[model samples]
Target: MANIDPIDARILARLQRRCDEPLEELGQHVGLSRNAVWRRVKALEERGVLVGRVAVVDPDAVGLGLMVFIQVRAGHHSADWLEKFRRAVRAMPEILGVYRMTGDLDYLLRARVADMADYDRLYQRLIARVDMGDVSASFVMEELKEGSALPL
Candidate 1:
């Protein structure tokens, strides 16, 4: 990966805030020419600094209003068991994210659902599918902040 200099950082900042900005507009914002900005953006992509652009969607608008974080601990932590659990979680559409952790729990899962009833059914399915000996989950009451921007 290329080291992000001041110019590169500026380009990233502008791009993060407005991905649809034209090359010339981005160049003006970053104090570079149109072609320079285009090359920098391409370089960033090549270096894997800029991954992919995506549109942020409203969960409530999509009818998946409830947010949940589920903690899971398995009966054992063998590699095969972990892989199986991961594969099982990956297949569930309701599960938005999954992370293996260093804390007491083996895995942390983020899921979205319509309501408590929906979550209950999802939880039951998870219990049936995962090789978990312990499971705990908490519902998100509020979203204080949510964003993917990283300060340069």
Candidate 2:
């Protein structure tokens, strides 16, 4: 783990809320000069503490209002099967996240779509590409809290 001091933690907390905040403003919050903040930010990036900076888009604004959580049971557990599954999911842009899970479920996928018909299309494409023993999905009715920020 990276050595994060109190000041660094403060800076990270602020950045997680708004990364595009001006360096001068961020420095004021963390009790540092703009140059010092810039140096620390550079060090954070170099240490892989800060991997990326991106614009978070609203799914509803883009016409993708449905959020789906898909549970998958793999028919086979071979290395080749895993590779094929990875390739298939990676190729599909609608699949936002794919996780190899433990316990009864083999994998879980998160995707965004326009509606039930769009979700059906995504499901069809997924099943056609990979052999799944069982597939089930749950739609999110209401999102109480959704964010990518990590608690420091």
Candidate 3:
């Protein structure tokens, strides 16, 4: 990790909440001049502490109301199989996150879709692209909290 002082932490916290906040306002909150905050932000980006900024959109509003966690068991563990799986997931925009996991599950996929039918289509497409031993999905009932902020 890069050297992050208290001010940098505060800046990161603020940015996590609102990436588009004016530099002057952010500086006021962090007790730094605008230029100082800018430099710090630039440095943080250079150090790769700060990645890309993006807008968080509402899934329901966008007609993607269902969030599903799909568990996958690999049919066979091989470089070719892994490469195919990676390419399949990366090409699917509905698949928001794919994690290579330990324990019983080989991989876990987080996806959003309009409904069960949409999910079925995604499943079909995925299975067509790659082979799997077993697949199961669980839909989210209520989201108590979901965020991208990291504790600084």
Candidate 4:
């Protein structure tokens, strides 16, 4: 990553909160000219700091009422096993997020389903495909807060 000074951080903070803000408005917020603000945004993108803009959707409204987190312990820790597991998880639309972790678990996965029955089906499918030694999962009781916006 390139050195992100205070100005760049401020620009990114404003952009995250209001991506559709015009160049003039964004520049004003960060004390830069419209052209300068535009250049900063472009540079941020080129440096991979600003990945992409996305629409945050409501999972419950979209027929995904159940939020589940699965901690998986694989039977083997080989490159082939890891690749296969990743590809399998990526192909599943219900699997919202996946992460490799440092713990007893090899992978941590976030999935959204309709209900308990739906999650059960997903669990069976996941284990059958990946040969995980152990699978532990928990349903989210409540979501206090979740957002992509940075604290900056």
Distance (Å) between predicted and true CA of 40, model 4? Answer: 0.8
Which of 1 and 3 is the better model by TM-score?
3
Q: How would you encode candidate 1's per-residue C-alpha lDDT over 63-151 as one tens digit per residue?
A: 99999999888867788888788788988999999998997787899999999999999998887876688999999999999778888
User: lDDT of candidate 3?
Assistant: 0.96
lDDT of 3 by residue, 1-152 (tens): 25889999999999999999999999999999999999999999999999889999999999999999999999899999999999999999999999999999999999999999999999999999999999999999899999999988
Residue range with the least summed lDDT across 10 consecutive positions in model 4: 53-62
In model 2, the clashing pairs are none
Task: Return whichever of 2 and 4 wins on lDDT.
Answer: 2
- lDDT of predicted model 2: 0.94
For candidate 4, list the clashing residue pairs, or say none: none
Tell how far residue 103 is off in model 3, in angstroms: 0.8
Q: Please give the lDDT score for candidate 1.
A: 0.89
Indicate whether candidate 1 or candidate 3 has the larger lDDT.
Answer: 3
Worst 10 residues of 3 by lDDT: 1-10
Report lDDT (Cα) of residue 32, candidate 2: 95
Ranking by TM-score: 3, 2, 1, 4
Tens digit of per-residue lDDT, candidate 4, span 1-152: 25988999999898788788899999988899999999989999999999998766788888898899998888788998888898889888899999989977888999999999999999888777887878899999899987788776
Model 4, TM vs. native = 0.90
Would you estimate the TM-scores of all the predictions?
Answer: 0.92, 0.96, 0.97, 0.90
lDDT of each: 0.89, 0.94, 0.96, 0.88
Clashes of 3: 0
Clashes of each: 0, 0, 0, 0
